[model samples]
Target: MHAALTFLLLFLMAGTIVPVNRHFRQTPGGIPVFVVSNGVHTDVVVPLREPQTGTDWLEQLQQPQLTARFGSYGYVGFGWGSEQFYLASYGGNFPKPGTVLRALLPGPTLMHVDFYQQAPRPGKRVVALQISRAQYQQLTQLIRASFRPDSTGATVLRNAAGYTPEDFFFRGRGRYHALRTCNDWTNATLRKAGLRAALKAPLAGSVLHQVRRSRFHAAAQ
Candidate 1:
């Protein structure tokens, strides 16, 4: 089991919808952002660069080794969670007994950032949204703020390699606990960015359902 995929926690899975900003028109011209999920986990994926603004994230994202290995990546997916679960999520195994128990308590957090080669497609496990330039900046700012600062007051990317060369872990802000889960962080990011998100999303199912329902509603309109 990959952690919480099978856990029987009694957290709230129901969530309410927050309408997208009235000023934030859902037009094709808006930047395309994607929320991807792996049933148990969710990631907020964003563009690597905005040609119009000439905003290059490589400098701020710590120039991941992926650039050296494969030139450059098109998109980046940011995830925050317990360091124990993240480190133990190597190969196919999830956290063991001790790891799981410790994760229940307030522990250090890490950002599991992954670089994508192509644009993420919106499917059953992916919800795509078109947001304004301002919204995109806001979303990115929240994500950036989650990174823990190093001694030099900069976001520190761990020297340790990731599951793949394309992804790496960074110290994260805030503590990971039973109440503020990975999915909860994801939900908070969206809500902070002034997007349509659930009222409560401590579980992946809760966040996924809210996003899917919002997408359906938008499509039906």
Candidate 2:
């Protein structure tokens, strides 16, 4: 009987261990969506998977498939990794190079909340970025303002704020990459503020091409 009990315990332990480890190693294809007015009024949505380009994943989720059944005022972005892991003081240990997480835009109400890391992946590699309703408007405005008549340099313009010409796009473990010119800037800024080690690196000149803007005609108009 004692031997039997020991074997059961061992089996249970192994069962728990495998899942916990698997979640940590799995690459995040997308992120959890939330519409929270504060810590109190919180509505949680399941992780949204990346959809094919031109498909509006956000609107589809907002309808009823999302458990929370909440409405969003904007779309927010961030990174992810294991929850309890410690992130490097600087931007070291982000993820394997070249992975990118892409979420289709719905409207503006969705805000970027904290990135969730499920389990054992080390170094808190997953990251999150949150924005208030006002911030979301400002971001969309910036994107529109910086948008050129041609799409040729739009990517650079989206990422140019506070970055030198050399700032190129990189990804974390969960396939998260910056979409616009300021996305990288915003991520780097958040990392600098949240993690001690995320250093500001020089941007390559070509990278700057997308970011340079003359002015927002909307302002003058």
Candidate topping lDDT: 1
Count of residue pairs whose backbone atoms collide, per candidate? 0, 34
| Predicted model with the maximum TM-score | 1
The C-alpha lDDT values of all candidates are 0.77, 0.25
Give the per-residue lDDT of model 1 (tens digit) for 1-221.
64565343322532433333323335456788888998998899888776755656676765545446544668888999998889998876877999988998999999988888888988888988877778788888898899998777777877458888677899999999987899989988987887767776876766776666543235435
Minimum summed lDDT over a 10-residue window in model 2 is located at 18-27
Question: Each candidate: RMSD to true structure?
Answer: 5.1, 21.9
Decoy 1 TM-score against native: 0.84
List ranges where model 2 is wrong by over 4 Å.
1-123, 151-184, 187-221
Question: What are the TM-scores, per candidate, against the unseen true structure?
Answer: 0.84, 0.20
The 10-residue segment of model 1 with minimum total lDDT is 16-25
Q: Candidate 2, residues 1-221: lDDT per residue as tens digits?
A: 99988985566334322221111111133232222222111212223332322323234323232223223322322322221121211143433332212221211111222222222121122223233333333333332232122244222212211122211121122222222222333323322222111122112221121112112223333
Candidate 2 at 3: error in angstroms? 72
